[model samples]
Target: MSNLIRLIIGFALVGAAVALFIFGHWGWGLLAVFFSICLFVTYFYNENMLIAQWYLRKDNMDKAAVFLGRITNYETQLNRMQHGYFNLLIGLIESRTAPMKSEKYFKAALNLGLHMDHNIALAKLSLAGIAMAKRNKREAQMYLADAKKADKNKLLADQIKQMKDQLGMLDRQTQVRYSHR
Candidate 1:
């Protein structure tokens, strides 16, 4: 189901829990609370991620951030793989405005293990971009090398090429600056 429908159902379950408590059905109320909490947790864990990813795919940053922002208590509730994906999504979102912050999220996702070469490669590419932005040429080169290795399908070949060209241009610019000094 869609995230909106799941959110509505979750709210409804919370209301049911409260109604059961008011009607003196203590046991049922407790059960309702448990189920509601489970539903909420499940909703927080899965639905937002799916919806946010869809928005991200469409390059709708505002919509994607809105969905992703709905998820709470990331560190405690999410499992290892889920946490990785969560960090990856957050990293992607932050990459445009705060690349330094995005780099940390991407690294965390990588350390936690995405288990998908394509995702790992993408994260690596983001890291390379961040490194390049920071003028960390060595780090950027390392990340690019890692991304190249992980991109078995060559899906990111164009991106890799662009970054490589940019890196070369930056290197030449730095070389000229140093030589002039």
Candidate 2:
């Protein structure tokens, strides 16, 4: 359906360009050609990003990672693409046999200073998870607090709060166990 719509629109634009050229409207024809090219590039670029996002959402991290890896040189202007790459990396760490290696990518993203809310939140969340895994409660809490501050999404905030509570409970349990021992 989408392909058909695209084909119809492409033909229509080409027809308009041809009509303008036949009418001796060189400027209009050139403008139409430029517009068509712009539209074509924009469509594919957007489509690739959407595909990557879809794969990520479906938890098909390998496919998402492949698609996202195909996108290079366009990251400077495509914050979402960069975010998607980082997301794929995080997913791979979560589901793959390899140990989680996302800290470097997350730190690089943070260093990019993109200020994208989602990216910042994800980076912080990743760091928080790492901290919690290492039993660094203070650092974990700090990262979770920072993530909560960076995003106003209630879901993310709630998740951070939950993580904090879990960490607190774990800490208390560890202390109780150690003291009893």
Candidates' C-alpha lDDT: 0.87, 0.68
lDDT string, candidate 2, 1-181, tens digits: 1434555676678789999999999999888878777566554445555676788779787787676666564455354545554543544445344435666666666765535686577678777887787788888889998888887665577777778888889899899999998
Query: What RMSD does each model have against the real structure?
Result: 8.8, 7.4
TM-score, every prediction: 0.74, 0.64
> Highest TM-score, which number?
1
Candidate 1 has a TM-score of 0.74
Over 33-62, each residue of candidate 1 has an lDDT whose tens digit, in order, gives 787776777655676788899999999988
Candidate 1 residue runs with Cα over 4 Å from true position: 1-45
Segments of candidate 2 deviating more than 4 angstroms: 1-48, 72-99
